[model samples]
Target: MDEQLMLVENLDMCFSTGKGNITALHNLSFDVKKGEFLAIVGPSGCGKSTLINILAGILRPTGGKVVLDGEEVREISPKMGMVFQKYAAFPWMTVRQNISYGPRIARKPKSEIEKITNHYSSMVGLEAYEHLYPKELSGGMSKRVDIARAYANQPEVLLMDEPFGALDDITKKQMQTELLNIWGQENKTVIFITHDLEEAIFLADRILVLRRPKEDQNSLNFIQPVPFSRPREPELRTCGEFVRLKAELSEVMLK
Candidate 1:
């Protein structure tokens, strides 16, 4: 097997409330290999988003550690990029500007920024709309812009928290195809979080099923490998193997 690119060791998260402390994640541990796509699926309160936040260094875990490339991660690292559930585009910025934001902040030369912005915009099929503001784009288009913006930075590890959850079924499927293509070309390690079991199976090389934080100290219920061949086709969703895995995952979630 490939050496682990990222490791989560006995991670825990707690938040204080008026009533008392609330545990959002409990002793969760996992490893992600370089260039692999991993999906996290669970019930609504199962700490999926909380786990992403911890990995991104947006929230410090109460216990345990995150190690990336053999070093413990204490804060946000340039090697990571995040795409939130919500459309994170700036309304005031044009698509080009939004995609170029990261490179600009990193003090990249204007020529380099323009080159990356153009490449990613075209990759996400947003070249024609590069000059358009966020308000003018549809939900699907806005999501594409968000993806383009993330890729523009060329982070080695990409974290997506229910990125396509808000799109319509048709649009979501299209975006999934687009995402897979981008993932293939970029070759970055990806950790995707979603509540949809089918979507998880369709996109991940491995699926991590999380349990509600209150249910157990070991929040990770299981880690199942996806057996489908790469460059998966839409037809694979109806195949027997895919159906069986989905059924198994559904049962696990409901239990």
Candidate 2:
């Protein structure tokens, strides 16, 4: 079995609104193993993005702790990288410059930045478009650049918050395949957030279902393992087992 990479214990988040305090997450807990792909699914207002933000150290939990490789996470760490739903490419920067941004910010040598940029640009199939700016790219191409930029940072864990939610179905499927291909090569631990049940089943090693907190319930409803063998092909989405799992998760989500 793979070693545990992260542990979230009794996590909670609350916001101060004029309507008074709103609790976004309530006593959420889970663990992610090294190199595992874990997908989080929940309805709107169930705190999925809030959980991702807390995990990224972008937001501090009101209670509980996030332990990464044994140490408690109090602030952002280079071991984690995020890809947002919005394709957050810098409009002024070319593809090469965007992908190399992290390394450059860390003051890596020019030679090393060039090597890292070239490697990841090719990894996401964006090598030929290295000179292109964000406006020149299509939706799918822009997302590829986002993935490349995140991975170029060489994070131990990658957090994606509905990164393909903006794409059409066909493009979303294509990007899923592209992402899996890159993930296979790198084997970095991934925590993916999505509302699409099929998308969750298709990509994750395990699926975490978070329920909207009620008077008597905790935020984490349950965790389900994906039984499908990986190197998952696009056609796997149509398989009987995949369909069954999707249906099961859909039911869970609707509850």
Candidate 3:
């Protein structure tokens, strides 16, 4: 079977500012393999969020194209799901209602929707809170609802933009493990955006490093493959290989 699932070619994004055009991304190109966990890390203002938005079809790029599943993407597709840094749960919807919103929109069978809601709620540890509204949930619990909602949609590729960035250190760590567990079970291709090098190394099969483009030069973006074996434990973060990889990524980020 072919490993590659998505192709990004010569991607570029430029904005019209008062001072003139501001280029957020230039000639960025890469491929995401089927079921691969790909993390994107970069310096601030390096187009990390912009890139994810374009991939999600939330924004249009000035140049280049994204091809997924052998077709060019020009607009939003049900095949792509997104989980943002901020909690995206509907304020008025109960946990069960929120998680099942996507499938319900697609007019899935009532039985299937119920099953999906139950499955992802349990997967994200929200089964106990399924009947509660967003106002009654903690930030962590709300974020769990966001994730479950995304997975419930059953997208071929999941796009995450710093989903745990606002959580406390303990909660962030817990979410990371939970995300990995969900990924293992779902076997979906994931494109995760984060500023945390350790988080990227911990969760990604390969890490893509992006640099801001200069007026006269094209910033070279590169990908680094993570070497750790699957089912990695939290203790792996303290190991020598993990440290070395993190150090290497840090240098890449700075350069």
Can you list the residue pairs that collide in candidate 1?
Answer: none
Give the alpha carbon lDDT tens digit for every residue of 143-223 in model 2.
999899999999989999999999999999999998898888998999999999999998999999999976578899999
lDDT of each: 0.91, 0.91, 0.91
- Quote each prediction's TM-score: 0.95, 0.97, 0.96
What TM-score does candidate 1 reach?
0.95
lDDT of 2 at 161: 92
| TM-score computed on alpha carbons, candidate 2 | 0.97
| C-alpha RMSD of each candidate structure in angstroms | 1.5, 1.2, 1.3
